[model samples]
Target: MPPANGAWAWLAPGNSWGWSNAGLISDGEESLLVDTLYDLELTDEMLAKMRDAEPLANNIDTLVNTHANGDHCHGNELVCGAEIIASSASAAEMAELPPEAMAAIVAMAPDMGEMGRYFLDCFGQFKFEGITFTPPTKTFEGELHLQVGDKPVELIEVGPAHTRGDILVHSPKDRVVYTGDILFIEGTPIIWEGPVNNWTEACRRIEAMDVDHIVPGHGPITDKHGVAAVRQYLEFVHEQARQRYDAGMSAFDAAKDIELAEYSAWSDPERIAVNVDSLYREFRGEQAASDVFELFARMAALAGYDVATP
Candidate 1:
């Protein structure tokens, strides 16, 4: 839904994982794309929708990737002409996992046994090939200001939480804030990076802002309440993980034992495994350096996936 002003969002509905949300802010002549989608086909569809709204969207002058995650920046090759921008940290993280990495994952899925099957189920449709890694040509640290013609847009870096560098696109003129994975509605948020406190504070920052429509990285168009809901989930999970840590339980055991009946209705409940593991590390004042594949393997096990016999 397009906001009250020139702000617009492309929300991919349902609980299908990796179906992230993107936004556009156009003022007739110039436009800014909040983020791209997970793959070539998805990004093409989103660009088509945006073009339908305004032809200016077809030639977006600036592309702001909220974070380095492939889902947010993978389709950047499609808009190579635009000057891409991101937080300095995000630009660094962008290089950490390239399109080839995704391609490798897809190829290895079959051999991964049950875990591989679940991996394909979550991310098989994405066409990772032909995705050129277009790192942000311009980067900023904390805040940056820009304009979609006359409407003002503010980019706020709020990370070392969702990822090494997550950001929010705030349209003060439209009273809208496009949070890139900082808030997820109707879905469990995987904590790829966290101090837990940084994430909760990020949510609180949004709560204090005088904004109307809140555009989350995934799920439906929301408001301040949606932001609060995500924050509450994170807080609850943090406490649960903390108790398990105090008892010296493994991340997998703690995740399996913790009851998320309250968030049971949310999609991708297996993400609790990742969230608990992340919070446990944070609780112990440890470095945020968990192995990605190891985390996924643990999640697959917790989700009742049976490993194939050798």
Candidate 2:
């Protein structure tokens, strides 16, 4: 359901692993897309829906990718000629993953071959096959004041949280924020880049905004309270993991013992392993950097019930 203002359209994919919700901001003459869908087919669907609403072929003048994740920017090539914008860190992260790597992942499972079948099962049908990468032309580090029609949309950077350079889009006129991946409503929050405190602070900033409705990067369109829920969830996980880390418990060991009593309702509780791992690493050493695969495998092991194998 799109917001009542008709200024932004919310596209909810209605899946656990797919990049759940995307928003489109309209400007009457020309519009701006907040984030593209996860894959080409999904992107095409989103474009079609938007076109139906406005009946304008080229209303989308610019595409602003909130982060570097494939779910938000992979369908860039399908937009014809919309100028893409993102943070410099997001652009850097985008460059790190090749289109071929994504294609290889897409080629697996439910689609065609067997190599990606397992991944497809685990992550759902998130295939970015044959999607061309379009780099961001405008990269800004801090806050950006964008004019979407008469309203001023604030592109605030809250990085080292969800990704290298995470962003939350704020609409001052409507008192609504299109929080890109920063707040995952009713789902497990993935922390590709995090210090825990950064996320907590990001929540604090949103709380201060006192916005009416927050369009999360994934999941449903919720109010300010929903954003608070994710923040509290992160805070609870951080403290729980920190306590076990202080006791000299390993990541896998801590993963089992930690009870997510507050966030038991959200999807993918297994993600607690990764959240604990990231917090444990940060608690161990803020400046310490571990291999991404090592962290992923450890989280996977925890998710696979190896933690309770003992």
Query: Each model's TM-score, in the order given?
Result: 0.96, 0.89
Tens digits of lDDT, candidate 1, 25-126 = 888599899999888889998898888977888789999999998999999988858989999999999999998899989989999888898899888878
lDDT of 2 at 94: 94
Per candidate, the number of residue pairs that clash is 0, 3
Q: Which pairs clash inside model 2?
A: 108-116, 109-116, 109-117
List candidate 2 stretches off by more than 4 Å: 106-118, 286-310
Candidate 2 overall lDDT versus native: 0.74
